[model samples]
Target chain A: MKQIFLCKDRLIFPWVRPIWVFLPLFILIMLPTWASEILSVSGFGTLGYQADNRSDVATIRDLSQRPKDGYATGPTWRLDSRLGVQIESRPDPRVDLVVQGLAYDHYKANLNNTITLAYAALRPTVNWNIRLGRLGYDAFLMADYRNVGYAYPWVRPPTEFYGWIPIFSVDGADAAYHFSGSDGIWSLKAQGGKSQVWMPINGGIGGGYHFKTDNLATLSASWQSASWRVKGAYSRFTSASDIPLLAPLQAGLAQVASANLPATSAQAADLLQHVSLEGARISYTTLGATYDDNTWLIQAEMGHTTATADIVPQGNMGYASLGRHFGAWMPFFTFSTYRPKSALNDTAYDLGATLNQGLRDPSVYMANSTRIDQHTLSVGVRWDFTPRAAFKVQLDTMRSHAPGCGLRSISPTLRTQDIHLNQLTATVDFIF
Target chain B: MRPLLTLLCCLGVCSVAMVQPTQAEVDVIVSPENPLRTVTASEVSDLYLGRTRSITEGGVSVAIRPYDMVDGLVRDAFFMNLNGMQINQVNAYWARLRFSGEVLQPSHLPDAQAMLDTVSHDHNAMGYVDATLVNDCVKILLRLGGGAHVPPSP
Candidate 1:
């Protein structure tokens, strides 16, 4: 890429950087009241650290964000540390405007992804709500509100369940209807949108990139009884942007096909077609249930995602946790697992074997990045030390049953045989 | 350093006081003009936890508002007897719902006097206060701990 300099360009709109334009606006979140009725501000944050016994691979809260390269050794604060501030304006009983800006470990350099929720909604009635803007992506049970550390019992949501979802927010609208059912209260929500998210990658593989999804539609329903809540949701989406790292490989395949080789040419073309994002589709179906009786809390969810991407395998992931409260303390245990149903196709592997070293390297990285075949056992305790804060510590021991990697970022130097890891984490979560 | 120690000591004492049971039981109350003369502890739980914002009155649905007295022994005892939930747990539950853009939280009043005043003025408002503070302006909905409270004459 090259650029030509001009005198007019230097003098016009000099402050075009994204950070400066939004810095002052974000500072206003510190003031909690603008005459109290029309405006209110609230926020949550966590001061956390993770101590790792095995550094063969790095740990990430989720694929959406990753820490710096060397932060995974011994102890690191970048994994679970985050701050989110939300400002809400309610001018009338039927209208509201909410904007939440979250600061976390981001893979992008710009401010576009920081604002998680910016929506203006119409509450025509107490039981109905419609909103159009950037809404939180409620892909799973706790995915939308996971940033609020004071809300949940564990130090964090189970990694195997929430790790694959990078969708922080979606650009679109949703309408929800709430009503009293014979058994309990029920709410149904339908949403549609287009979304784009920046994803992190190992520098050894490729630079961080952003991908877009179109025709994104989701339908979810939940019912709450006295102490039980059960919810189910299904969503479908199509990839609107190709993986940037795939461009080089696609180019290589095209070059080889153009040479008119008989067997390799057809394989190259077929593999090329399967790897495209033009019409690639993905769908997810998830179910979750929880029971909380003001003393014992139980939560579990299961989700299965099927996608057309050749590099990514379809799989099921779920976790269940049970905790009992004794005065101010809650001790819990969780078991989570992810199992892939299919592996790389024989044709793609054959092609990779015959291809040159340059093309083969990135293909391996792409395949590895999407792999998941692991289970984890975690034991944690949360102590509500104050009215608005809690202290929690967790120990996670994970083992992979196959060569495929778990949902965390892996160093290129990691060996497949070294598939066991034990990590310890502690955090103090607060809300204001 | 002395001041810091004193502050820590004060916080510890306040936390201990928050858990200790109070001798005076709180009473749930509503406006005298409001249609709801009595409600169960579970119904009050649902109202305060933000499960339902309206109650059925005279075969017609009537909107109701629930108010909370600012954090204190009254608020603490009300929650402790309502469902045995601590103030922190209740706050956490509301935080989850509030930030999720689901249900609006109960308005907070400065003190029992203010809560009584607000509820008595608004036909749709419901609140709880000290039993000894009740009067004819507000009617007793449900006595929390089976204690008898006589309303003062107008």
Candidate 2:
């Protein structure tokens, strides 16, 4: 009884403090400048509809059906969009404040109703600036500007490539100091913080563990010259495992003992298992570069991760994109891939087994552990209908492959042969 | 008599074009503090584009005050030299940074007077108005190397 209350106390209350901290800052920045400032409000949204011709590939449900090529699958996914407002104290150069709200169905499923981004920045000297409260990382390319359509050439980032490591933004504090010389210009940024997240797998044997990490850091540098510009960044994520939920896996007899309990009592017994929660380590690294001139922008990135937790499957991913701009529009294309070093375990259950028989083979109870590869091709365009706003549309074709599973009922046939999935999306993004 | 009047009108227009300010004077007016010691066209482009970030000695923040879209010289010199990115792209760049809670847009001025006010207050701020409106408040950093702007005065 005490434990449940403690979980709620530890997890639930800490997140709410930031919201309270943010609201007053918004009013404080706006209250003084209301008369002279421009209350600029803007928003963007994507009404995405996708159809899966093959049920075994990228379907939200009924993965075992393996429907025929022409089968009709209902378009099942959608997103609730986002909007923000910035109160610009125009003629006064030093201070400006922004408040934004983002809502997506997937995030909301875990009771994350309104993701708020609010902050105040003081640029005392143009070369040196410091911002505090709910700041996001200035990651390579996609990490920083996922929303603005005009900044990117593609409709959306290639999912097959980026889907491997899914942490999008960080909430923290960041500072930048700039230096310029005859040879080139250089800038540096230092940022650190923690974020609340939901992983696809739990920390135990089946998937990922539920907890937050402490070691998050990013260091970035850039040099600019007449003909070209170069930049690179490195970031790390380290998790400390202390959750009481991970213990049961180490006790062989505990599994047998739990099997004998009534279903309801078994649930209580499972909470007693905490072995896997002990000292699991996790981290990842990223690097990127970009060069652009009058006609083109070329960019690339490579990233890798090492994790002690079984939930995080470690691997490497890389991508390259090229784009060109026309008068009011631009078109571009990209190619990228994700390669997993080892497969995650697959779990299956056997109803026919005796109480002592335990679960069937590990593969039957957990996800299949095998090598997987993902390849993607994307093409898209941006149209600027107005000076401050633009619209973008992009489409991608992805193929994922695993080895040796041809079952129509038990597996995604991509294991036997490459499976194809298509995504089409349109975004209306703007700034004031 | 009619022919004479017509000739006078053509001469008036031609003289206006010829008297357009040179690139050096424009440079002095854009950023008054920085000395104009034979800077290259590339240097001018870098200053306005926000890419170079600093000047001859140190890394200085490049302040840009974008004029209304219809402002011909602002579009030609700023956007053309920066990255060939249209106004939407520039706006998007600031927006992305803004949404990320990184930085706000560089100070925006509605007209030449306001731009001059900003430039006069900060040595790092760089902007442009009519060549005829040049003043002692700000030094001309560099003249935009393009057709719309007049060449610099010797």
Top-TM-score candidate index: 1
lDDT of each: 0.74, 0.51
What's the TM-score of each model vs. the native? 0.86, 0.71
Return the TM-score for candidate 1, rounded to 2 decimals.
Answer: 0.86
The sequence of per-residue lDDT tens digits that candidate 2 reaches over residues B90-124 is 56555655566555545456666777776787655
**Each model's DockQ score:** 0.40, 0.23
After superposition, candidate 1 runs with Cα above 4 Å error:
A1-33, A70-72, A203-205, A254-266, A277-279, A347-365, B1-24, B146-154
Residue-level lDDT of model 2, residues A1-432, one tens digit each, is: 646954775586453335466657667767767666555555543433444355543332111122222122334433213344444343255555666665443311232324445656677765876766565656454665554434555654554444444344455667888766657667788877655454322111233334454446778776666545566777766654443433433344356545675553353233222123334455556676666653677778777766554434456777888878665566878888777666542222222344224332332223232233666787877666556545567677766666422111224323556667776656665554
Q: What is the C-alpha RMSD of each candidate to the true structure, in Å?
A: 5.9, 10.1
Instruction: Choose the strongest candidate by lDDT.
Output: 1
Superposition error at A235 for model 1 (Å): 1.5
Once model 2 is optimally superposed onto the true structure by TM-score, how far is the C-alpha of residue A332 displaced, in angstroms?
2.2
Q: List pairs with backbone clashes in candidate 1.
A: none
